[model samples]
Target: MTSFRVKSEGRFVAAGCALIALFALIGAPVIAQEANMLQAPAGMKPSGSVPESLKSDSSSATLAPADETGPRRIVPPGYGATTPSSGMPQAEEPAGPSQFFPAGKRASEPSVRMLSAVPGQDNSGIQIGTLTGVDASTAGLISEQQGGLGADMWQGASRADIDRYLSRLPVPVRSPVMNDLARRLLLTGAQPPEGASGGVSLLAIRLNRLIAAGQTQAALDLGAAAGNERSPAVAAGIARAALAQGDDRLACDALKDIPPGNDPAHDAMAAFSVKLSAYCQIAAGNTEIASLTLDLAREEGMDDALFYSLASEAAAGITLRAPEPNKLTIVDTAFYRLADRELPENAVEIVEPALLQSMLADPSVSDEMKVAAAERAAAYGLLDGRDLAAYYRKPSFTPEQMAGLLTSDIPESSSLRRAMIFQSIGMAAAADERIHLFKLAFATAESAGLYYPTVEALYPELDRMVPSDALRPLAPAAVRAFIAIGERSRAQDWLSLISSGGQMLGRDARELTGLMRVSGGSPQSFDSEKASAEIVSDLKSGVRATQLYAASEAMMLEALGFQLTPAVWDALLDARGALTGDVPPEALLNRLQASGQKNAIGETVLLSLDAIGQKGPGAVHPRASAQAVASLKAVNLESEARRLALEALMARSNAGRG
Candidate 1:
């Protein structure tokens, strides 16, 4: 929301041209204007003959000294000197064509005095390009003179009105191809007619591209002009653009123009910025940059979120291992302060997880800073599947302190704070196995007086933040192996390491033993002896008895000399849930007889079942059942095997007890 506000306010519209024209003409010495003049970057002077036709309609207006409280200068994308965003879009490309995930998020709005085309209330039908119904003559005139010039000219003609004039021209009429008349006139001495102050606004709309193109010196020179002569609004705008375009040094120069204010907007903005930048510099693999930036942002007022954004990103990058790629530094904070100076709102959310990511790694970020960072991240409300490298590195929240967040008079700020709390709750839930932990975390977040309505606050950022180090990094194969090998301790450990919110479905040894016994004792036809042996083999192999009937039914029938009842696996499954936790004693007895085994093995199955029932979840699970003992008689179709089975059970069970 803040970023969006910044982008929209950064470039003001001319609002019928009168407002800008009036501001520019209010106090100027009405020099007889000649042909329209072209703008040029500093050191590149323009000199050319004026067209005779242009001279015929020369115009001039009186202009005023700019008010100290005039509106702020707007910044275009890629304008900051400190923010180093690559061409990386915010999302991955595999899901479809190239597109950013968590789409349609707006840029941040600055709180500083807004430099706008006009009050938003002034007009309704205007297009960003032109005042909707202007006469063709005026359009043609502005169009013919306003089109075609790049980085250098833009820096000089950086005011919003110039951008507005640029917009009014139809694309075809505003061709960049300069004719001899136009080019020659620019070569001749032609100062762009003065703007609102009868003075050129140094910070231009085209500042970003110039910076991108490695024209840093030009930006600095323009900034110097603004610093020397413009109001805080224009100066700050230039500073923000330079900062965005990646030159903190120039940004520092711009910062000097920010007035001395007790409200601390400037101070906070500056302090919060470097505090984090220093930390992130180390985390994002640039200690020097982080340190230097940190030192500079420190000069910002404590209220500034830029400092915090840099700190959090630095800290989070180190802690969580994932850093946000599209980190817009302090562009929005500067504006937001001017928007509502007395009641300055926090500006941490504009360039999020980057702030979130960068801070996690910075060792210098103190505990108090973390609390500040977590609160801001939670408020931003991370989305599902969004990179959460920062949130994962350290606790996303602290339960202790939440001041005027909820109580703030501005409902919007309060609501945003609540949203942050809700997100923190979710993070807590993921970390602590209990839902209660999540609730507590969330409640603590809301206590800050922030508002949160839905889980929507913590968006599509799937459980990606649950880190490997934070949680046991168990692979699917590892989990499978643990399950197969009955490594319950290890399995549970892994499960706990991951988020607390998942289910497991592994069979218990005790449950299996009871199942075998219940099947063994059930009434079945034919000889019980062969049935007993088949049941034991199935149990050892972890196959259910019903399945045994499908393949082993033939062997059992022949051995029994008679057919038994239906396969027992199905009956076991049916009755299993009702039995001990899952296997009822009665159901087990029934399944026992259904196995078509003898009285001997039946005893072994029952004994094993009974033992497990007496002992509980912690008791040693019987490898063989009570009936297997009774089946001991059956097992020694050879006595040696019978003895071995009994010995193995006793040894294992006793060993378990010891």
Candidate 2:
């Protein structure tokens, strides 16, 4: 019985051992997964202590102290822990799963691990760098090498002074040389004047002046070069100029760049933005938005009846007979074009010369109107001479008008008369007849105070004609016209014809010689004594206007480095009695001298324009003209100074004749 019991006990122990082994095998994977959950991923640092429930209780399964300095073993739950006994074999805890799977397992799937956010950290309003101001005065489309004033142009002047001078610059500058100078000054990329706050006020003034002066293309170019399209004032100017140029797309893009709540300070500009925004929306086919914008503009107190009427008409595809405003701004003119409405008969009378430029190409206008518009535009230096010449060629004349052009009573309509003369000159078979027509054209234009425009239109035609003996009697006027347009080489050619034709001692020859000398030419028969005597006679006996003209002639000659006799200088002082109406202020002359002495190029230019005033170089006092020329010379602008002097001479001479 004892033997049987021992055997049974042994059998029972074996069964229990078998059961324990089966339970261990089943729990191994669960324990391994739990260990993985507790262990840190391959790149992450392990944190927190093993769970108390999973800690081994056996004293021999010792864990290293939490504060121990050396590397500690990470034992998984259910594993017996032991310190490393010298030379005893010990198992290393299993490493975390391999980051790179074996080749076959790589194709199983890819997994993404999302990280948790750190506590109490703020990620709002994070910026990379500090913001700073832009130097807007450095903006320009022209470089110094391309005839711009240098970048240092405004270096010595104050911002306030620059702003004042720029504001004073004449709109529709009638003198071509002054017009050119004004454009160059406005477009030059120069340093900001002293005391500038890095704002665009100075630039805005320049752009506005350019737009007001019919230099819309220049204003557009300058605004683009400035890279300040985001500024409301600049964008407004650009939009207006673009509209004036008939580029609705460009205007829309400019208006769109203006940020909300940054409208310009001027009422006109603010109104312009509000009205043009609606127009742009309509142009872009966003009719609903256009309506909303127009409504918003009205609600905001934009009181431009012309614009609203035009915009409403455009939106509804119907004509609203809007009465012409007393003063037509560029925006009004552009909208008038968009609405396809005919301008009033007195449109030219009320509109600025700058606005007249748009009508030159409008097919709806009569040819007579275009000619009249081109004449005014050309006179204001807004239209190119070649363009005016082209307009002169547009009118079709009847055979009767052509046959009686010179002989018939002059047409009542000045436009028809000028066009007939221009066409007749082109058709005349004889040189004398052509030359006579040329004289007649100039004389006809002169009678109406349109001499300069006539000169510009007919210069190219006269320039193409080769000078000869037969044309000598007519050569003096041609020479004068050539000199007026700065075609000195061509003028010299005609002067040679007069000299070779043996008319050197005639009144025309003496006058031509003096003019040529004053315009920087070296004519063959220039008699300084004879010219001086004639000038003195005019200054002594001529009317107050004629005396002023003679005095200006003497001053210009002296300015061009011609040493007129002392009597001429004394005569100029005598002629000062004739100075009436508006004269350049003494303070302005002082400031101009100061600017010149400092070599402040831009300041000198502005002050010079001011000294010349609205009526231009011809109408200003002789002292003003001479001072302007001298100041310009002081700044090393010899070419400009010479040209200014020549224009003054020509303009005064024309005024004398009139």
Candidate 3:
């Protein structure tokens, strides 16, 4: 629970920081805080401090009134049932990016510059002239559009509402400001202000805002403080919010008002509440109470699809000791999953091997859970390569799913065991799953330090795995893996298939495959500009971090050669910048100059590298450092090349530790 609070607070604080940064970029003036601004709901304080009030029985506190007839609907501004209409005028939403982040502002202008060298001048020969001024006021808005906490926080929240709230602040704090603003706005609209006993609409709105901001503790505390308005509707709302945030204890506390009872409503809401209550009980470790609660729900007329579907999660963990009455039934698939969770131990009465095989074949059981069961069997020395083979031979799971599951939760050391399991099973997998599984086996093998056996089993399937002509474009990754593992023949086979089918590899993929071919007399090749563009595409497409790191590593390997492509050159420069504190400038300069020999990369690259190395601004607009070193070496000026290399290394070392 302490750790949970720490983690939750961290998440909220991070969100708050993002909001603050967004507000700063938008030119929103920060408001000074009154003493009350620092106040938050009990238990919502930063980690390491707990309010004594929260330490008490939180559910016993007053709650906002609930309407048993139906959920509360917040009346829009200007439509009040009790007080005279305030008639708040609605502001039309911003219609375009310009409305929010205005253009033509001083910061929104752009500038251009031109560079030329006076013929045969020394290092000082080149001059850069500004051709245009630059404005960047719209830059912040464009970045926000790209996605961050600012975007997520602003989502579904009206800009008008936020602006009104901000205008009231003397100086806004970060994320907590959003929560406070939400509370203030809700209260401002409440017909009977703060102290008055009214409907739960204000409380509901505030709690919703808190929940959206991931400030669940504040929401729970606020729900408990709503005095006379506390009702089943309000309590249920708070409980639902708690459950959504994974606070089972808070949810259980909120739902206590709606205890299990006979003659529950036959409608969907009642059914859903009943199901939620049961799960809440289970989560709170009151298994017997949960079981009874679930039974009572079934006893009522709650057979709707929505109720059943929500009930499935709890049903998946329930253990039935004895057969129950038919009326107490639930979806069978859910019950089977519950049984599967306990696996070999629960299935002790069943025979070996078959039990393990059945566990894999069961669709309701997740691959992750199955992996756990297999690991458990392994711990007891009962797991066999044969049983593993059976899991793959039957083909209920895909290689990608299994790989993801195996890696998702386990310790790094367990990856060794995973490698062993894959090696055992790869040979027996059906053709459809074989290549993918072998690839997984190969990838994990390196980490396990058991590369040979994994590759030995994988080599045979290489040709068979290459997709047909139209699909060749998609198998570059498969080919790259073969090259990485030194299976040159298989790599060639796949490349030939791709070529025969008349498909072109993506630039990065082509360059990578070319690196493999370079060992077989094909020239080492790369396009630095194309590589950088490809990297941006990968980032935009949300490629996983692991994949990005692999790509970066490949670029670094290519940078080792004398001819630096734009991509490789930039990657090396970035790497050098990243490694600044780790390696001294002098050592790097010595290494680059000592290794110098050049082909394609030119003088502009050397000049940039020289400037960067010397802690000076680079003169070039487009390319960078390693290109300069290679370019210098290409012109047969070994002495100049070495000096520039040394300078670049020194500058790199002075940069921040990556």
Q: Pick the candidate with the highest TM-score.
A: 2
* Cα-lDDT of candidate 2: 0.61
> For every model shown, what is its TM-score relative to the native structure?
0.20, 0.70, 0.25
The regions of model 2 sitting more than 4 angstroms off are 1-135, 197-200, 256-266, 285-302, 317-322, 345-358, 361-366, 406-413, 447-453, 460-472, 487-507, 521-534, 579-581, 654-658
lDDT minimum window of 10 residues, candidate 2: 1-10
- True-structure RMSD, every candidate: 31.1, 33.0, 26.1
Of the two candidates 2 and 3, the one with more favorable TM-score, higher being better, is 2
What is the descending lDDT order? Answer: 2, 3, 1
- lDDT (C-alpha) at residue 546 in model 2: 66
lDDT of each: 0.28, 0.61, 0.34
User: Which segments of candidate 3 are over 4 A away from where they belong?
Assistant: 1-147, 151-248, 256-268, 276-299, 304-658
- lDDT by residue (522-593, candidate 1, tens digit) is 335434555544443443454433332222322222222233333333333332322212232443333333
Ordered by TM-score, highest first, the candidates read 2, 3, 1
TM-score of 3: 0.25
- lDDT score of residue 196 within candidate 3: 18
